[model samples]
Target chain A: MLTGHRTWIYNNQPVIISTGTVGGPFEANGNIPDAFDILHDDMWLKQSSFEKAQRTMMEEAAQIAIKNSLIQKEQVKFFISGDLINQITPSNFAAKTLDIPYFGLFSACATSMESLALSAFIINGDGADYILSGTASHNAATEKQFRYPTEYGGQKPPTAQWTVTGAGCALVAKNGEGPRVTSATIGKVVDMGITDAFNMGAAMAPAAVDTIETHLRERNVDPTYYDLIITGDLGHIGREVSMDLLQKKNIDIPEEMYRDCGLTIYREGQPVLSGASGTASSAVGTYGHFLKLIKEQQVNRILVVATGSLHSPLSVQQNDSIPCIAHAVSIESGSDNQ
Target chain B: MIFFWAFVVGGTICVIGQILFDVFKLNPGVTLTIFVIAGAILDGLGLYDPLIDFAGAGASVPITNFGNQLVHGAMQEAEQHGIIGVVTGIFEVTSAGISAAIIFGVIGAIIFKPKG
Candidate 1:
């Protein structure tokens, strides 16, 4: 709903652009550029070419995470990822080229955090030292799989997510100096199946922020305990409603202290009307922008919860609303060293 | 005979695009861009012109049809000029459409007291 806090994060980077909408407008635009890498789950691989899309999105996600992580090609040690597709093409491709001994896992949107949680566990369990986890989703791909085509021109309300057309990547290591995955309290899928896809973002946004609140409670940290925390791609309306709800729970979150991935994902007035959603919205912002902030000592502790709306065609046909789930992954940059 | 289906199908596609605008509340430009790109891809794969030839203006007036026009115009230019065909590109291929949008946008801006 607002664009004020972004300046503090990027020193006022000119990344997000807004389109002028008429009054009575309550939606955020989610458009990014062509050259800007997207988290599209399918990468527009067409109906029969889904496998290729999966590979492209996953590899694209991994390459991005690796680049932002600044880890050598072989230093990744392990790859973790997941998706809604058969055999997890995104995760497969994320692991294929780097040859870091891939470990694929899927809990949908929560996979971002799930991967982080597992990576932290491995670091804690004496498995691999450095782990990279990510997830990617495409509007075209997800629309084809879950809804209609870009050609369908179906009505989408503000509540629905704009299925982020990109991937999100994260790198977790056993540094122990930065805010570690201190502890995580995961939430179950609370989808009551409100199948209207347009409003799905609104539905999912609450679950995500709530999980964040819970994660903070479990860690025994206050809302301001960490400098900044970011939520996955909840569009304009969802972001506003989530903050309102958080404040109701007495979580004093300054607008600057928290950010939404969708709000930061695009350059507006292009094509994508929402900010950014898919796996990429958070992936790029977190790994690219979020990690950069963490390293700069701008903020020490951060909590991130990648959210997913677990709506299936089967559930929609049953007159159900799209169900949403959120997974929390707590991360902190340890003293800017590790 | 084929024109009948062209009129029905192409008109339906246009109506869908419009409804997407009116009911779905999507902007016309974005809707146009998506369909036009889709039309270009379909034409590159060789599956759109016959319908256009059939529907005539029905397929030609809307933004999706404009995209088809661009693709076909490009293909025609490509054959005649070989590699240099796309050099002129938007000006040669989509001059009228681009001019129309610019002209209309300016006119809309001028005619309506715009406020951001």
Candidate 2:
């Protein structure tokens, strides 16, 4: 049911039965290496192009999710996914290979939560018994499209973010023994006139704050309600800015309770400038790392706000300021687990 | 005949880059920088001119050509205006591309709206 403006409260909580995460060599060495089901030694993954490798990563993630769920591919009712590439080619090609009823989405890095929320909505509405939702991104493929090609040797500014080369998929079902999607809050497009593409965290931070504040207000819940509140791809700058903004509004969320996926995925001394930002930033972190924690009974309830900078190469090249969006999904651990 | 030579030369250069990327696991940035510097060093030694003569556009159009142009500009200015011109003249040859990118980027940013 549509509740509290942009928020949707699911009366029939859809469960995330299983998840699959795939990462490249860089991610394999990063903080959440254990979260990945498969890790490739090279970015190419034996494919001729980085784009093809990304497609394979997404396909493998979907297959892994299905396998973990103990279900056949034919039993999955729908596949909803997206990527950072132009036209989301990786997701499209992967969908082709999966041969399931597919829905292609483009929400920049926020696609992970966007796809998951939609899949949960469908399941709660009795639209489908089982669905696959996920997002993927490749560093090389993303760099070639959004900035200079990897071969260019162009020095990026300190604020520039590293696009993650990874994919994550979750299999959502009507009934399961896992975290349940309780509600979702859709975001509004907010543009702060930030023109620098390298500093996307600043550009998208406002949108994330907007959605987060709205989600709390609509539900009449305080920020302390969730055990953890996470945001997607809000690197250092965005995270700091969001904290300041939230504080100004008297929404004092403790630092321990709030974390950004971009900040959590990588450790210090890594070459990632501002931090990680991509479709897989939130996807892999949530599906692989946080879900495992929930299964271990370490966390009870959580809120994930996926932030996306909605800008294309054409838009950036044309000197347009990035418009950003964020979507928030609430998840709770199974009562049976306790 | 000239088109065939151009295609072959360009294709070979691209293949070399691909091989470096695949075999050495070199990032595209490092590989491109190596090619450009290699072109500049060859040009300084008066070897790249012959390759340009033989390959025509193939030698002059790739990123290696940017290095060649930089060295060529610096060398010419050094002959005319001593040491100071060397630094200033490097931009003389590359200013067109840089300025066009900046100016056009600014104009585009002002005109377009970011969508999706």
Candidate 3:
């Protein structure tokens, strides 16, 4: 590794939304809708079960990983997974058919990296053989839990991200010089009790900033040491608020060096009522794109920060405050693969 | 030169919209709102129909259409009800969005008996 760390190996694969559900229209590429509608239906059908929707994505992620790695299911050791569900049925379902030990986690959308972090730790600890850490989040499920159902069609603020309809899973290895999960900076839930539910991106921004700062501090690593710093889907508003707030703290990370997964993954205006944020937004993008970048050695030392807004609709409905959390995981790309 | 000027001016305006997106951190919907508000304000003073003539969907698709509908509704309601008439009231002078929300909200409460 360029930074004297265990290098992580990555194989980036593009996620074609062929076999998955799209909440709304996924404006194709930067400027084109798909040349033709490939969905079973001409229009996006809203599913009733969050688990059903989440599974559609998790399975897609697993299939992609299988194809990319060309590894069999039996080859994987422990499958560590989590999701924003009743008992994380999506991850459990993903694991049920797999040939591995499954450990499911729940920390809202932060579950992805929380799973990845622990996976890295276990791999480094040498207690586990080979593992796959994954998480799936559903847009409809998150909204029903945190805000309203799609049928509700409530007036959405521009800052809100439409929960992305996708899942992201990563295969972690203890051997064969794959991309190794380096240092994981765990984050505590930050509760500011900001009451404007419509502008949650702003509310969650402070927590993300705090976590990033804490992660760097705890690891005693500088921002310059990493080639790119990525954040989970915070959408347009959260991204702005996060960058402005971070710069004020004297963290001079430029806009280019940092990519907001929420903004990067979705079409600029595909009519995301809340904006772009669902478990799938980060999942597909990180698994599909960022992993590709890592494989290409486009950026070596990368810090992946996934943010979660831990507010359920019940809490909001009952006039309780929103608690947000962000987890940071460092994955160093292995030069040997390149 | 004149056609070139037209293309330059038209393209520059769209480019400015993109700049507002990239650098100024404006959401498409919010920026759309601003454009519509500006158009509506101008149209209120009888000045923007020509812009509509020049730029069809660009001017019409925004919130300016909302304003136009509200203005039309108010004028029609005002005319029909006369000075003594309170057609749909001032708050609901535009569309049934407010009226339906209040009336249907009460109906839903009665029917559903929602839990606290």
Candidate 4:
């Protein structure tokens, strides 16, 4: 049911039955190496191109999600996925491989939650019995498309974020026992006229803050309602900026309680300047790490606000400011069905 | 002594590019353009030739050299063929480098796929 203008309260509470997270060597050496279901030492994953590697990762993630669940591949009614590649070709090729009814989405990094929220809404509305929602990104592929070539020796600033080389997928079913999707808040495109493509965290922070504030207000819940309110791919700068913005708005989410997926994925001194950013940053962080914590009862509720910077290389080169968006999804442990 | 100067000069130029990128927040494309323009202007002022004589390959190896070559070719042809030679001579000295880049790029594309 529609809770407010852009928020959706999943009355049926579709459950995320199983998830599959895959990472490259860089992420395998990250903070949550064990979180990923599959960790490939090779960035190419034996593929000729980085795009093909990305597709392979997505396919592997989806297959792992299905394999982990009780359902078969045929039981999955739809596949909703996306990536940061041009035309989102990695996801398109993966969809072809999965051979499921596909709904290719593009909200940049926010695609993870966008797909999840939509999957939950579909299952809640009896649109499908099983839906696979996921996203992927390849470091070299994203760099080649958005910034420079992979081998380009240009120095990136401290504010620059590393594009995650990974994919994460979740199998959501109408009836299952896992983390339940309670609510979702879709964000608006918020631009503060930031043109520097390197500082995406700053460009995307306002949108994340806007979505989180709106989600809290529209859902009639306090910031403390969820044990943790996580933002997607808002590295160090963005995380700090959004936190300050939240405080200014009198939304008091404690520092420990408010975390960013970008910061949580990699270890310190990993050379990921600000932190990790990509469609998979939030996907893998949430599905791989936080969900395990939720299942282990280390954490109860989480509000994943996946942030996205929606700017093309052409748009950036044309001197267009980045327009960013964030999508928030509330996940609670399935033990408490109430 | 020549090799030492070349190393120092080339390293200094690279350091300037790095500062432009890291401190001034200029992108690689912009930084390279600035270097090229600076090279052309220095060549126009007849300042780059002495530096090239002193530093040899160091002064002539960077992207700045491309700009110097462009202006140098244009000026030489302008003396002989007047105004129209300016446009015609721009690519004269740098054609080998550009052509090699294209040829090698195509060959690389054919021979090898991008590594991760």
How high is each candidate's TM-score?
A: 0.61, 0.76, 0.65, 0.93
Worst 10 residues of 1 chain A by lDDT: A16-25
lDDT of each: 0.61, 0.89, 0.63, 0.94
Q: Which candidate number maximizes TM-score?
A: 4
Model 2 Cα lDDT, one tens digit per residue, A1-338? 99878899988999999999999999988988999999999888888788998999999999999999977999899999998888888899999999999999988888988998999999999999999999999998898888876755555767789988999999999997889999999888999998778889999999999999999999889999898999999999999999999988888899998988998888888999999999999999899988888888898888999999999878976778999999999888988433
Order of all candidates by TM-score, from best down to worst? 4, 2, 3, 1
- Model 2: per-residue Cα lDDT at residue A100: 99
Per-residue C-alpha lDDT of model 4 across residues A114-198, encoded as one tens digit per residue: 9999999999999999999999999999999898886665668889999999999999999988999999999899999999999
Off by over 4 Å in 1: A1-51, A60-77, A93-101, A152-155, A158-160, A175-181, A268-271, A336-338, B1-116
Supply candidate 1's per-residue lDDT for B100: 87
Q: How close is candidate 4 to the true structure, as a TM-score?
A: 0.93
Give the per-residue lDDT of model 3 (tens digit) for A183-249: 7677778888776666677777888898888767656678888888888877778888889989899
Provide per-model DockQ scores: 0.02, 0.03, 0.03, 0.47
Predicted structure with the largest DockQ when compared to the true one:
4
Q: Which regions of candidate 4 deviate over 4 angstroms?
A: B1-12, B22-24, B54-58, B78-88, B99-115
